[model samples]
Target chain A: MLQTDQLKFAYTGGDTFSFPDISCERGAHWLLLGQSGSGKTTFLHLLGGLLSPKSGAIRLEGTDMAQLSGPALDRFRGRHIGIIFQKAHFVNALTVGENLALAQELAGVPVDNGRIAKLLDRLNVGQKIHRKPDRLSVGEQQRVAIARALVNSPELILADEPTSALDDENCEQVLHLLTEQAASVKATLLIVTHDGRLKDKIPNQIRLDS
Target chain B: MNILQLSWKNLINKPLSMLLSTILFALGVGLVSLIMLLNKQLDQQFARNLEGIDMVIGAKGSPLQLVLSSIYHLDAPTGNINIGEAKAFLRPEHPLINRAIPLSLGDSYRGYRIVGTNHNIIDHYGAEISEGKIWEAPLEVTIGSRVAEREGLKIGDTFYSTHGLDINEDLEHDDAGAFRVVGILQPGGTVIDQLILTAAESIWEVHDHAPAPVGAAPAEEEHDHEAGEEHAEGEEHTEATHAAPATDIPLHERVDKDITAILVNFKARNAMTLNLPRTINENTNLMAANPSYEISKLFDQLGLGEQVLRWLAYIIIGVSFLSIFISLFNSLKDRKYELAIMRTLGASPGKLFLLIIFEGLLLAVLGYILGILLSHVGIEMIGQFVKKADRYGFTGKTFLPGEGWLFLGALFVGLLAAVIPAWQARQTDIHDTLAEG
Candidate 1:
């Protein structure tokens, strides 16, 4: 469902990164492993369409991401791709339900409260739907973030070190939930992290050299 | 869910800041609107009563006082003018005068002036009698509609007059005989609506008990005969004799046998009209004043107070704008991470910009509504105070001029205050911001 070829990126007056090419078939789960300063986060951003690649092309469901710019790229990213960042962040002023509804609205799609409630229920966070994101515990907040990423049912899901802040048991449980949710939606999953614990669980892996 | 809803949530999140900005904005707008209401009403009141009469001739004092007293009935008279000396303009055959109405002052009932004038003054105000006949005899008076309504006086009711403009029972002229209410006039919406009308003979008879001047004949029989003839001639002929009969009181007697002032209307605008006031001031013992000119001077004197107040209001508005800018700028700093998250959720930079601007506009709209309500309440309070203190009835429901423009001005201020902050929000780097968090 996703493919990239020699993707490269650089910040202003900063270090440049040339990423190894990778390809994932539909419904495949993979791990991207790298040490510190190895452009793991940079490669995730380029694949998510949050940043334009300096050179090369990222193909998602056959459309080249480099050709999209402005609002068109933004809409494409919102509808076809979802990213779970390392930290759980939300609009603090809104309740969990409103935050989820805001995601649908910003993606320019009709909001389905039933779908949101069902998704949260599957993640075991249905009872906290009315509570603000800050009022929830760390585990509950992580589950809500996962639900937010999966709400659009995008084709490709990218996670950036979502388990780094949790204990081993909670980290294993979170990874199991992520893969199970990805499998249920039939979406390809790619997790970028420095944690070695995830290497044995998902054998399909790509490593970035520093 | 919507942009407006999101903006509302953002504003409510910081209640103290929004409240402070709204209060300051309301105060500034309220003061300006109050001044506009007062200025417009004052102009309307002055302009409505200042019509028809061309010049006021009275004792030599402040020309403004003469206009205020004889035209608006709002102040004490300068002094009295001799009817004999004022007779030239009072005559029907005068070359440049069309109508001259005489006023006899120095008495009031319950703070309303008892203007001792003929029915020509009634014609001058265009008042139609709603109840009874006009006064035909000495001590018979016609009450204006407002005076009758306020004092509960009807035809056939009798009341005693006091010696001056204020209502003090110790200065009551009860011994001068009670004046009967012979008529009640319809409301003219002019200065005449606050007056009690009587023949000038009533004033003479009231003060006739004062010691006579030296070498003056008693003329008691002539006085009685003239009063009876005045009753028979009705009020029409009384108009022509308002000044002439002063000389008829025997010229060798005291010149103090006088009326308060003469209000003159010109037959045509001419060189004589230009020179009339100079002629009166130079040759006669009376001072002539143009009501419009004196009123313009009054506005000029009042303009200083208006300017100072206007500057204060503008400064307050400026401060409100600054406060709004500061509050928004600080809140934008706090929400920078949240805005980046929204961008990650697919909100465009333009949408974020509009969200910030919408918050500012919401505050301004709320402040403007509060300010308008406050000004109306203030106007009602002032109307009550003026009615109680001066017996001048004022309506507080008048819609002020320039308020529509004021609305636009307030919206412009909101837009101006939000521009920089909104631009800052639009330029937020989503990648850098999310990376930090």
Candidate 2:
């Protein structure tokens, strides 16, 4: 479960953007709708604890993430949040399997190769585990990214413009995989995007004003 | 998955840059290390030969050349000193002098110097005979260990001496007396090991006369050779000439003899003995040179060139450090995003900092190991040429203790080159970098 109250942020010398409060329970999926410059990505980043809000409480399972800082905050985010970006990026030096193993290690959990293989098999990216990210196809790369994000079975899943680069068929397949994986892990899912195709996919909605 | 593994992967990813940095570092280290090894080995050789003897009394010229020729046998002597003037200190019962060993040079066989000195020289060098007995008369030679092994000279072998201290065929004294090897010295690891020893009277006997009938005498000496026949033959020839055994004639009754030098040791290093070199240099025509002083001055002169080379080696190392800094800095620019992504995946800023440092350290350690190996191999190859040319016995098989400091110095260079890049990695703005994508 996740909740936020009057979250505000500002880039250096830029105008402040105030975000609305939102409460989501376990295993629920939501689409955060916005136009360009609407600060939806900023809101998702705040919820993921990548950026601390200026003045607000972002409570995830009863702890205010805005109060955490430094290594504690980094470890908290790794253990509790899964983030997916529009373009699938990875540490290019590592293979797919190694990237997942790094994610588990950074999250302070013992590396579980069996769980990683099982998750990759479920996402249909099992064959690409030993391949470098650059050698994987776009859709396959996206699936591997999803597997990395969900490897820790985090409590909250955040996707920032997840389907902006994908075609309709691949976009639909990715959205289905994201929701189904979130449900299996019993995590709250929030997808932030300007893409209108995702509006009909999830009923729970939060929209940011430009 | 670990930081070290990730650092290794990143280093090998750009193999060309890594190879360039490593080779540059290795070249600098190898050059510096080779200079040190050569300096140490040459110093050991010089010091070994210079032990015990206080001063060298020879014909006046360059003091360094006198020490080199008389002590090391590595140069031409500064002409010969007359024994009439030098015998003042060469007397066995001289009050100020503990012992004086005469060296009469100018003849060599197979490039090894044939030194004509008495048994006092053998006792001074602690050279024990490994085979046969010491030479008791003229033309009865006792060869050094290295001379014996190199020329295959054994007891009773006869070889003719050359005119100078070289292996020139034109200088062969075919009409002169042939030196019969009466003994072979043990491997004493001193200058004596490279010499062929005989009584100093032999040198005078050989040069004072011309065309002795001993040309055919070597074949007859070899077949019926006994110690008595050789000694009697040598004594009969020396007795016929004015160059008699040095001890038989009293110091005041001696004739003028042409000896090259006298290696003198004082009973005590006091004012009288210390002042002897200045007194001899000023009053007498012979030059008295302190071996240790001349050797140190020689090293100082050679140290100038060594210092310049050492500075050059350090400059090369500094330039290599710069190259390493540039390589690490440039690669960080390309890896900024990857670093930010690592932060987002829960890697702390400290981890990113350590990762960059680890990469730099890996390069340095690799370069250092390669450099040490290259230097020893280079020295071994150079040692072969030096051994063939001057026979100084240079070797690269031993490692110096200072190389441990060099290892630390190399690691310090690695850490120094990595500091800025690692600091930048630690300061990486995760939000901005991730959002730029």
Candidate 3:
């Protein structure tokens, strides 16, 4: 359902391409592994509609995301995309449910308390609905971020160093949650990480320099 | 997430920055709100005072000053006219003339001044007594509700009159006389609350039979000494003193002789537009000032006075908008990877742009809420100070927003400020941002 062609992108007012041709397709647990400044993150952004490729096209359910404008693209992204970051990007002022509710609202979906409650339950942090992100532990916060990302039931999941701050045991649990949720939705999963420990478990990886 | 979620996240991401922005927005909008409240209350007050009268004729001085003093009770009176001269103009056959209620003011009981007038004053003003009927005769008084309450002066409470504008001894010509609060008038929300309403006979009576202080000498013997002294000095002094026209006879014994100004009400539609006021001013030593005209003139300098303040508020609001723009723009640079990741997940660059724009919109909504709250509180605070000053006698104590449309405009500006920055974020290159992720 998701595919990226030989995507090429360059920064405005600069001659250098940030990354070379990047390609991705659904049904694989893909990992963009590279050293810092090696363009692995750049490759992930290319697949993500956040950056338009100068010489490539990205197709999500056969519609090019790079060409849409304004609210149309926003609604499209809200419904079809779920992103996780290294740091939990939960809104600090909002309680956990409110944060997730915000995500649901932005995606043009009604706030389904049942789904959100179940997600928080599966994450084993059901009691923290009213707690703000700042008051949560690092592991707990990451769980909230993961819940927010998957809450919209998008067809694609993107995580950037999502498990870096987790303890070894929590890291395994978080990664398992990301992969399992993506599989449940039949969504494509992409992890941009320098964490080599993930390679053996995913069985499919895309090294940025390869 | 769309605008609400994304915008909320941005605001929460940096708690300190968001707080600062909200505070700035509140200040910008609060000033404008305060001015509106003041204008509304003061204008309401000015309009109330202008009611029930067409023209105010007073001692020849600045017409503005006369209106302010007679009607508003805020500025100095132009001059005091003699009752004989003022009544002489009331010819029985005059065509444009209607009821002329002469107002003689000088003495005050406690903090409120005594306004000497005939029953025509009560009839014209229709001031129903909140507690008792209107004053019956001279030396009788009708007090306003505020005055009665503040001074604890009930219907029979008698307070000694101090001569001149206030309760002081500087211009102490008479201090023995007193005004008995005869009636308490209803709350009219005008300058009348600070007035002591009585007949012109009351003022003449207060001056008459004014008890001499505890002393050995008497007034008739003293007058002989003054007359003997002036006579010995020159025959010219004797002539001038005699020329005073029986002014020595305390006229209250025969008739009321001290009407400071006559407020004339004419039925002619164009009476105020042309001849009457000019005739009154030109023919007599008294000056005629139109209350509506002068009061409106006070508010006419709006381009700089009120408008400038509003413009300054707009500029402040603009600055806040720019601040939101800059903050969102900076966050955009930082969220490049985040946006890129969302894009890869199938969020189009357009979606990303919308997300950013929506974030801006959210910030504006938040700022607007805070600004409106601050405005309400600000008006309340202003009301407190104005109540304390009691200079202009504004009746209400709450900050009431008069122009709801203007408030909506402010809200729109706040939203626009937030959206611009968020929109700018959507324009960032997802391809490049994801690379750095």
Which candidate's TM-score is highest? 2
TM-score of each: 0.90, 0.91, 0.72
Following a full C-alpha superposition, what root-mean-square deviation does model 3 have from the true structure? 8.0
Off by over 4 Å in 1: B209-256, B390-396
TM-score of 3: 0.72
Candidate number that wins on TM-score, 2 or 3? 2
Candidate 2 residue lDDT tens string, A1-210? 799988899888987899999999988999899888888878888898889888989999998999999999999998989888877788888899999999999889899999999999999999889998889988898999899999999999999888989899988999999999999999999999888998888999999998
Least well predicted 10-residue stretch by lDDT in candidate 2 chain B: B218-227
**Stretches of candidate 2 exceeding 4 Å from the true structure:** B208-254
Q: Candidate 3: lDDT over CA atoms?
A: 0.67
RMSD per prediction, one decimal? 5.3, 5.0, 8.0
Write candidate 3's Cα lDDT for B4-93 as tens digits: 555566677788777777676777777676677768877887887788677888888788888887887776566667655665445434
Fnat, model by model in order, equals: 0.52, 0.55, 0.28
Query: For candidate 2 chain A, which ten residues in a row score worst on lDDT?
Result: A85-94
Q: Runs in model 3 with CA error above 4 Å?
A: A1-210, B1-6, B91-93, B169-175, B209-256, B271-273, B301-304, B344-391, B395-402
lDDT of each: 0.83, 0.84, 0.67
lDDT of 1 by residue, B1-437 (tens): 89989888888878999999998999889889988988888888899888888999998999999999999998888887776788776776789988888888877899999888776788787889999989876678898888898889988888877777777877666654578898999988787888999987787665553233232222211223333332333232223233334323422133445777888889898998979999889988889999999999999999999999999999999999999999999988888877887787788889889988998888888778788778878888888887666455556576665878888888999889998999999998877877666
How well does candidate 2 match the true structure in TM-score terms?
Answer: 0.91
Clashing pairs in 2: none
